[model samples]
Target: MAGVRQNTSIPIPAIIRYDETDKNIIGHEFSLLEKAPGKSIDQIYHTLSVEVRTKMVHQMTDYLIELHAHPWDGYVGGLTPTNGEVTPGPPIDENFGQLPDLEKYWAGSESLESLNPIPSQGFAGFVAFTVGCLDHYIYLCILLAWFHLLRPLPSPECKGRRHERP
Candidate 1:
C-alpha cells in the first residue's frame, strides 16, 4: 500500500531490529525480508510487448523447469498451515460442495443463488438433477475459460465480466 509522491523514486525495503519501533513514525508495521524482493509479476507481464512477452515467458519456462528439477523432500510428510505453509485439510464436508467454486471464491450470495434454478419435480427428478449438475459444470468451465482468455477476470467487484463473444 506504499505510494510515492513522485514517480522517479525506487522502493527499497528497510531492515528493522527487535529494539526498533518502526510504526512509531512510519505509521505501519515492518518486517525485514531476509532475501525476498517483492514485485507484482502480473503488473510486470501487463507492461510487456507481445514479442517481448513470448521471449520472457520462454525464459520463465526455463526458470520453472529449474525449479521443478530441484530436489523435493520426495515424500509427503503432510506439513501444515501451523508452520505458515499451506496443506490440504481433511476430506471436505457435504456442505463444502454447496460452497463457491474457485471461479466464484469472492462471489456474492445473490450471484451464486442465481445459479440455482428450481430443479424439475417429478418421476424424472433424478435425471433432471443429474443433467442440471452436468450442464452447470460445463457452463462453469466455459465461463471460466472465457474469463481467463479475454479479460483479467471478475473479482467480487466485477462479477459482471460476463461479456459474451461471438
Candidate 2:
C-alpha cells in the first residue's frame, strides 16, 4: 500500500485501517480501504477511446518506473510487525503460496502459524529458497523420465516407414 501511495501516477485505493491481528475478526486479518473512484480498467477498457488508452499506457509506464526506482532493504520477504517495528521476512504470498510456488511447506494449524514471516538471512535465504525449488523441479523431471521409460510412447508413422505400437 505504501509503495502504491508513494507513486502518485498509480491510482490505488486509499487504506483506511489495517488490522494484522485477527483477534477481532472471524478469519484472517483485514485491511479497510477507501473505495477508489471510477470503474475498474477491466470494466471500461473496451469502451475507452484510443487516446484515453494511450494515456493510460503512458501513466502505467510512469508508475512502473517510479515504483521500481525505490531502493529495497536487501530483504526477500514481506514486512513483519515485530516489537512494533516493521521488519523484512522471507517473501510469502498472501494466499499461503511460497515465493516461487514450489509446494506447501506446512499443513493445517501450521499453515496459519506460517502467516508470520520467516526471517530471511539476507541473500542466503533467497539463494537457499531458489536452490530448493530447483532441486524439487529436477526430481520431478527424473520421475517423468522414468515414467516414460517404463511406458514408452508410440512411434509416429513416416512417409516411407510404417511404425508399429509397442
lDDT of 1 by residue, 1-166 (tens): 0111111133334333211222345543334533447556786877779998899779778755754454333321111132533442221212212333412443553343334322322123345545656665675566557455755544787576775655
Write the residue-wise lDDT of candidate 2 on 43-143 in tens digits.
88999999999999998888778765655544444555557455554445464443222233443434432443333442344575566446545644553
Alpha-carbon local distance difference test for all models: 0.41, 0.55
Model 1 accuracy (lDDT, Cα): 0.41
Error of 1 at 62 (Å): 2.0
Off by over 4 Å in 1: 1-39, 76-166
Collision pairs in model 1: none
